[model samples]
Structure formats: structure tokens, C-alpha cells
Target: MDFATPRRRRPAEAIVPMINVVFLLLIFFLMSAQITPPAPFDVTLPESENDNAARPADTLYMDAQGQLAFNTARGEAVYDAIAARAAPDTPLQIRADARLEAQALARFLPELAARGIAEIELLTGMP
Candidate 1:
């Protein structure tokens, strides 16, 4: 003739195992993820100590002689070609030689800006 109330049972799930799994996944991603540098055309670029900057795919190159190139093609032809292919919002990267004067950049940037390209990045390598 007993009439005592039944006891409640707690959930058997443990957060420790879940936390361990999360940590393992984090470590796996950290180890598996690879970082690769962007390959622009062959050009001698300016050197800098900062190497953690992100690069854009669309690059404009200026050689030591102040000759311009987009990718591999040289001179104004490449500039026109790039202008035709690139969108207004294309991220433009400039890889100019250290000896290349600022006047070269100044001349082209205005036209690039006029074409609705506002985002410009200067490429530099680790010294």
C-alpha cells in the first residue's frame, strides 16, 4: 500500500564530449587549411615588411621603365583590354617597380577611377 512519488531522471547527454569534438574540429581545420599567395605577372615589385595583406586577382603592372601591363600583355593595348573586361567594381591591384615613378601611377589612376574603379591596392613583397 505504498504511495510515494516517483523520482525524476536527468538527461544522460554530456557537454564534455561535445566540447572535445568541437576542439578537435577546430584543430583539424587549422592544420588542414592552406594559404597560397596570389600570382600576378612576372614583375619586380616594391619590397615591404608587411606580408599579411590580401591581394586581388585583377592586377596592373608597371616595370622599371614605366611601361604598363595588365597581366602579360604590355602597353596601352593591355590597359584597354583590362578596361573592357573589368567591371566597375573590380578590385584593382597595382604591382609597380620601386623605381617606377609616382607620375606613372598618377596618370593611370585617374582614368581607372573615371571608369568607376575606386578600390586600388598596391602590391609589395616581404623585404
Candidate 2:
């Protein structure tokens, strides 16, 4: 007859706790992150001497070649989209390539005004 008691195995660790922590971390990051749509095309913003910091909204993109994009719309269609979305009081931001011609931009401004866009802001990078 055996006098000694049999040894018991240790219980397995719980993976549920780790999974819960991982899910919690995921939730935190998702909530904290600011998600914005990428620019329709690459743009190299002009530099400015002013230190003014402004957040972009209802943005229009202009390439060096004078290509226009607003949200998913491109070229002439961009104007219609902008006209539909913009309120007379709401400001529109333009992210134009530094290499874009000033005359091209100047020509474009009247079109925006014709579309009833009153307030406009040009977004530029800091030197």
C-alpha cells in the first residue's frame, strides 16, 4: 500500500485574460486615432512665413499640373461637388502644390466665387 499522497498538476494559465487585454488596447487606439481620408493625389504644399496653424476641412487639392480634385471628384466635376457641399458661410481649404502656377490659382478663384464659395483658405507648410 502507498502511504504518500499523489501530486496534483498545476492548473493551466488562462489565455482569455490576455485576449481581453488585447481587445481593450485595440478599442483604445481606435477611439483615440483621428481617421481622415488620404488626399486624392499627392500635393506639395507651398511654404509660408506665417506660423498660423489651421485644421483642414472640405479640402480641394491641386497638383502642379493644375489638376483639380475635391474628395473623390476630379477635374470639372470637382466644382459641382464643391458647390453642392459648401455653404456660403463655410470655409474651404485648398492644398495646392508649391509648383502650381499662381495664375492658374488666380483663374480658379473666380470659379469658386461663381460657385458661391465665399471663404477660402490656402494650406501651406512651414519652412
Candidate 3:
């Protein structure tokens, strides 16, 4: 006659603990991730002596090639598009090339001002 005792059955509760841990980790990562707005182009901004304040959420760019873009989207007239999207309360940041002509910069200022974009922020790299 066999004298071996009947094998005890293990509880099926292990899966429940693993599932809970996985869900907790997923929630943590989602909360920590940051979402940023896209840019129209890739241009190296000129550095400034004073680099105060953080970068703005809304940015408009003008590259050295005289191309106008918004939030990394090229082939668009920046002034009109930015004016349309901008409101008096929300300021628009301009990241223009240092080598860009003064006349060109001068021309756009009035357009931006006329649209009630009072708070203008210029972005520059760290010197």
C-alpha cells in the first residue's frame, strides 16, 4: 500500500497580487510623463547675455533661410497664422536667427503688435 500523503493544493491568489502591482506601476509612469507642444522647424537660436525665465509653451520660429514655420510645421505664413491663433492674454515666443536681417524683423513686429501680441519673448541659447 502507498504511504505517501496526498499533495496539498496551492492557492491561486498569486496572480491577483501580480496584477495589482503591474497596474500600480502603469499609473505611476503615466502621471510622471510630460507632454509638450510641437515646433515648426529646427533652428539654432542665438545666445543671449541674460537667459532668464523659462521657455514659453507657445513658440514661433524663423530660420536663417527666411523660411516661416509654426511649431515645426513649414511652408506657412507665420505672421497671419500666429496672429490668428494668438490672443491678447497668451504671449507668443519668437526664436529668430541672430543673422536674420533687421528689416525682416522690423516688418514682422508691427504685424505681431497689431494682433495684440503684447508680451513678446525672444528665445536664445546659453552663452
- Ranking of predictions according to lDDT: 2, 1, 3
lDDT of 1 at 58: 74
Task: Give the true-structure RMSD of model 2.
Answer: 4.0
Backbone clashes under 3 angstroms, per model: 0, 0, 6
Cand. 3 Cα-lDDT:
0.74
Q: Write the per-residue lDDT of candidate 1 for residues 1-59, one digit (tens) a residue.
A: 87888865555455677889999999999999875454444577788888678644677
Question: Which residue pairs clash within candidate 3?
Answer: 39-71, 39-72, 40-71, 40-72, 40-73, 41-72
- Tens digits of lDDT, candidate 3, 25-119: 99999998887765555677787788586654567787776667775455546665776674547778878887778688777788778767888
In candidate 3 the C-alpha lDDT for residue 34 amounts to: 83
Winning candidate number (lDDT)? 2
Candidate with more favorable, higher lDDT: 2 or 3: 2
The total of clashing pairs for model 3 equals 6
Candidate 1, position 39, lDDT: 42
Q: Which model scores highest in TM-score?
A: 2
Residues 1-127 of candidate 2: C-alpha lDDT, one tens digit per residue: 9989887654544667788999999999999998999888889988899999977578999999999999889999998999999454769999999999999999999999999998999999999
Error of 3 at 39 (Å): 2.9
Which window of 10 residues has the lowest lDDT sum in candidate 1?
Answer: 35-44
